[model samples]
Target chain A: MSIKNEILKIEHLHKAFGENVILKDFDLSVKSGEVIVIIGPSGCGKSTLLRCINGLEDIQSGKIYVDEQPVIQGSKDLYEIRQKIGMVFQSYDLFPHMTVLQNITLAPMKVQKRKKEKVEKEAIELLSRVGLADKKDSFPRQLSGGQKQRVAIVRALCMHPEIMLFDEVTAALDPEMVHEVLQTMLELAQSGKTMLIVTHEMSFARAIADRILFLDEGELIEEAPPEEFFTSPKTDRAKKFLQTFEYSKK
Target chain B: MNWNVIREYLPLYIEALGLTVKIGWLGIILSIALGLVCALILYFKVPLLQVIIKIYIELFRNTPLLVQLFFLYFGLPKLGIRITAQTCGILGLTLIGGSYMTETFRSGLSAIDSIQSESALSLGMKKHQVFFYVILPQAISISIPGFMANIIFLLKETSVFSAISLMDLMFTAKDLIGLEYKTIEALFLLVVFYLIMLLPVSLLGTYIERRVRYAAYGD
Candidate 1:
C-alpha cells in the first residue's frame, strides 16, 4: 500500500543477535492514523520489529523517523521519542507495585508534570473506557489477564503516544479473554491513533489491518491489504503460510 | 543480692544508655544513607561510579568492625589526625553498617522492575525524578526492614566502643565491675541495658516490614 501520508518511516532497519539475523534490511512506512498488522510464524522477528519501532530494540544500521524527525539514529531524545511512540508488550509490562489508577497516571503526572486533578480525571476516564473504572485502586496482581492488558493499553495511551505498537498482546491471555483485549485495540484504532499490531489471530488482523505484512524468517514475504493478502496471497511463502493457518480456527 | 546495690550506679546506667543510643543510632542512620547511595551507584551503575563504590563497599564491609574502630581511633591519631572515641565509635559503626547497607539495598533495587523506570521516563521525568518518584521510594520501602535489622546489629556493635575507652554502656559496666568486684551484677545489668535498647529496633523493623508489605501487596 502507498504511504504518502506516512507518520513513521522505517528505512533499511537491521538487527542481529550473535549469529542470528532477526531482521535484515527490513523496512516499512506507517501512514497517519493507519492500522498496520504484522503476522508471521514464531521467531520471524515480528515482535523485534515492533520493539525496534518503539526504541526498545536498537537497529544495528538503519534509521526510523517519526513525524519527519530521525527518531532511531541515536539523535532524538529517548524519552521524548518514547513519549510519541507508545508500546504495549506481550507481557503487559505494568509496574507490579502500582495500582491500576497509579499505573495509568504515573507517566502523565510524573513526565508530563500534569496537574494531579487533570491526570486523575483523565486516568479515571480512560479506566472507565476500558470497563475497568472500579479496578482503579486495585494492584496489578489482582486483575485478570484481560484487565491488565487493557490497563497496559491505557497506561501507554496516557502518554498520548502518536504511534501505538501492540506486540501480540492477546497471545498471553486465556483464549476466552482474548476478545476483550482485541475489542479494546479495535476501539483504540477507532480513536484515530496510529496502531501497529503484531498478532497471530488472522480474523483480528483481517478485521482491523489496513495493510497486512507477513514475515517469515525475517523476510517480508507479503505486503498488501488484508483482503487480497489473506485471500489472494501472491508469493509462494504467503500461499504456503496461509495454507498452514491452523491458529485461525480457534 | 539486693536491688539497692545497683541503685547507686543508676545514674551511671542512664548516662551510659544515653551514650550507647547516641553513638548507635547516629552510626546506623549515617551508615544506611551511605550504604544506600553506594548501592544505588553500583546497582544502576552511573557513569564511572560503579568501580569507586564497589571498592569502598569491599574495603569497609570485609574488614572487621573492631579493626575499623582501631584504625580510625588509633591509626588516625598516629597519622596526626585526632578525633574523640565517640567520633571513632560512630564512624566505625557507619563504615561497617554502610557496607552491609549497600549489600541489602542493592538487592532491593535490583529486585524492582526496570519497566518502572521506563514507565516513569515515558512520562518525561528526568533521571532524578525517576529515582525519587519511582526507584528510591520503592527501594527504601523494600529495604527498610533490612535497614532496621542492620541498625539492631549496629546497636549491638556499639558495645564494642567500650574497647576504645568511650563512656558508652559497656565501658561503664567495666568500670563498675572493677570498683565493686561484682562481676555478676555488673554483667547482668549490662545485658539488661542492651535488651532494653535493642528490643525497640527489632520491633520497629517488624513494623516497617508489615507496612511495606501492606502497601505494596495489600497483605
Candidate 2:
C-alpha cells in the first residue's frame, strides 16, 4: 500500500520498563482498512505497542505516526490524537455506575460535545448493532461477560474513530462467551474499520487478520499472511511455540 | 412537678433549643468544609500538607472535646488569640468533627472503582475535575451516613460549651438549675433538649442515606 494510504506508521520503536526491554527496533506500517493481529509470548509488548498507537504508553525511543500524525514527544495534543482513536481493554472497562447506554454516550457527550438527545439516539443505534439494544438501561455489573464485551465494542465504535485498538479484549471472558466477542470483531473487520489487535485467540487471528505478526522476546520474529505464517513459521521460537500451541490449547 | 412551671419554662426551654440548632448547623457546615479540604490534601499526597493534616486529625481524634474547647477558649488567649466561647464551640467541633469526617470520606473514596479514575483520565478530565465530577459525586453517596453520624456527634458535643459559658442549651440549663435550684427540672429539661437536637438529625440522616443509596446504585 502507498504511504499516503497507510493509517499507522511505527518505526524503530524501542521501549523498556527499567532494565527489562519490551519492544526493541520494531517497525510496522498499517494500511487503511486492514486488520493486523499480533500474537506472542507473555510480556512481549504486544499490548504496549497498541497502547503507544493511541498515546496511552510512551515509546522510549522512536515514533508512531497515526493517520500520518506523529504521536511521540508531544504534550496535550495526545488527547486530540486520542480523540481520533479508540481502545478496548482486556477488562471490558465499562463504567459500572453507568447504564449500558450511558456508557456508550459518555465520551461522545463529553468530548465530542454532542447534544444529549442526539447522543442517546446514537447510543441506542450502536447498541442494536452489537445486539444489546434492549439492555440499554442495565448497569454493567448486571450484564453477562459476552454482553459486556459487546457493549465495550459498541462504546468504542460510538466515537467513530479512524483506528480501533483492541488489547486482548476477550482474554477476560469465559470460553463459552469468547465466540460472541469474536463474532462482533469479525463483523467489525468486515466493516472496513482499521484495527490492530493483540489477542491470544490464534484461530480467530488466523481467520480475520490480513497479516499475522509473531513476536518473541521483544522482536518481530515473523510476519506473513495467515496461511503461510501458521503453516511455516520462520523463527526457532515461532516453530517451537506453535508446536507447543501454548496459548491456543489454553 | 407543677403544670404552671412546665407551661412557664416551656417557651424558654424551646428558645434555648433553637440556639442549639443554630450553633449546631453552623459548626457542622464549617467542620464538613474543613474535613473535605483536608481529606483532599491527604488523598493527593500533597507535600508537607499531608503530614500536617494527618497529625492534626490524630491530635483532635485522640483528645476530648471539652479539653479542646477549653484550650481554644481559655488556653489560646494566653497566646493572644482569644476566641469567644461560641467561637470556641465552633472551632472545637470543627477540629474534632473534621477528623472523623475525613476518615469517612477517605473510606468512601476507597470504595470507588479504580477504573473510574482511569476512565476519567482517558476522557481528558483534569485531576480535580475527575474527582469532583466522576469520583466524588458517587463517593458523596457512600460518605453521607458517616457525615451525618459525625454531625450528630458534633451536635451532642455542643453541650460541652456550657462549661466555657456559651449560651447553648446546656448553658441555659446551667443558669436555670442555679437560679431555681430545681435540679430535677433542669436535668429533665436537658433530656428534652438533647432529644430535640438529635431526633431531627437522626431522621435527616436516614433520609440522606436512602437518597444516597438510590443515587449510588439503587434500582
TM-score, candidate 2, is 0.88
Which runs of model 1 end up more than 4 angstroms from their true locations? A1-4, A73-76, A235-250, B122-125
Model 1 local distance difference test score: 0.83
The interface RMSD values of the models, given in order, are: 2.4, 2.4
- Kept native contacts, fraction for each prediction: 0.37, 0.12
Model number with the top DockQ: 1
DockQ of model 2, rounded to 2 decimals = 0.34
List of clashing residue pairs for candidate 1: A111-B123, A111-B124
What interface RMSD does candidate 1 have?
A: 2.4
For model 1 the local lDDT of residue A108 reads: 81
Span of ten consecutive residues with least summed lDDT in model 2 chain A: A241-250
* lDDT by residue for model 1 (B1-219), tens: 547767877789889999899888898889878986888788778877888777888898788888888899889988899898988888899889988999899988887787677556544556787787678767777778777777787788887888899999999989988987877778778888898998877887898788887787644
List model 2 lDDT by residue over B10-127, tens digit each. Answer: 7788888887788778888888888888888877789999999999989999999999887888889999997777777777887888898888888888788876766555554445
